[model samples]
Target: MNTRPIAAGLFDEGASPRLRGGRHRQTGRFVFPCPQGGERDSYDEVRLASTGTLWSWTIQRFRPKSPPYTGPEAFEPFALGYVALAGQTIVEARLTGMAFDAIRIGMALRLTTLPFATDPDGTTVLIYAFEPDGDRAS
Candidate 1:
């Protein structure tokens, strides 16, 4: 899918966000899907669109939770935390494409896609990430 820039200097890995749950779900819930479906439980992960501020973050100086979490475990640490999207929802994602010291509360951030890992069958997993807004390096 073609990624596009959205409001407040945010860019998603897809064109436009797919609003899930209509009005039944809480406002600000977003699901990023490909032009089609059939992967990773039908792409049901909630992602941010345009307006989010970095509420807070924590540096993961150790390995992540479990299988499928394919980030650095030994040498390089990663950041994990929540971003406050508009409408009173906080979305948690991996922080990328910037230095740890550079991250601060209220910094601008947007959705990103990074190569997660390769499955035993080599299917490859692409995951959602968040980086400084408008910086494509993320």
Candidate 2:
């Protein structure tokens, strides 16, 4: 099936996925996907480092309020966490392939694209997920 991001610029299109962001031209502070406008309104697109340490996390067991969420009628609990990038922003994303009890602070993680859902038009929408950093061969 043809795949596409849940949103563009969330990650780079390449052999490996790299998170994309915007950096403030003057302050050098970064924002995920894009940057918030400043007084001068200067910003530049930049690829964010894919690896970061797991900061903190939680499990959302209930369906979130509608109007924004458009998932299936049946909801499944999932892991959500904050990852601290080195000298960069802390990103929040769904956790994958890790047991609930296995998550820990400072653990290594890598950004990845995971299957979200198939759209009405038959496009596979992929969302970002942070997984335990390691070789898949292992």
Candidate 3:
């Protein structure tokens, strides 16, 4: 299972799992591993969320500089963008599983987890992405 909780102390009201330095039940803080950024201790707050609009986007014509970039070299075109979450901090990520022609500015988007690819060393890279909100992408 994708143990990395998409929602943790974020929506849950409390003394704050992060502020208290306690491990979050969903995303896991002090202990367990986070599939997204991996086991250290950065997801200590609500830095990102699903409630963002498609502020802007662009199609990349070349492969990224890392192994996790799995888009076909022949294809040479993929979407990436900055998702402005409800609060501060903007999440830079790829926008996929949708058609470029249909994507537009100011569209509703939700947070999603995407499996990039396995590295030569055998570590699976997970990426945080956003997808158009079903029926609310306008």
Clashing pairs in 3: none
How big is the positional error of residue 5 in model 1, measured in Å on the Cα after superposition? 20
Tens digits of lDDT, candidate 2, 22-77: 78888899877675446336778888888888999999999988768866668888
- Candidate 1 residue spans exceeding 4 A from truth: 1-48, 65-75, 135-138
Candidate 1 lDDT by residue in tens digits, 10-103: 2334533322211113333343332133433433344335446788899977666757555434446778778777763566777888888888
The true-versus-predicted C-alpha distance at residue 55 of model 2, in Å, is 0.7
**Full ranking by TM-score:** 2, 1, 3
Encode model 3's per-residue lDDT on 5-119: one tens digit a residue: 2334322222221111234556453322222445324544333345578878999876676465454344547688876655444556668778888888777877665655545
The superposed Cα distance between candidate 1 and the true structure at residue 71, in angstroms, equals: 5.1
Which regions of candidate 3 deviate over 4 angstroms?
Answer: 1-44, 66-76, 120-123
Please list the Cα RMSD from the true structure of every candidate, rounded to 1 decimal place.
Answer: 8.1, 2.7, 9.1
Q: What is the lDDT of residue 105 in candidate 2?
A: 81
Best model per TM-score: 2
The TM-score measured for candidate 1 stands at 0.60
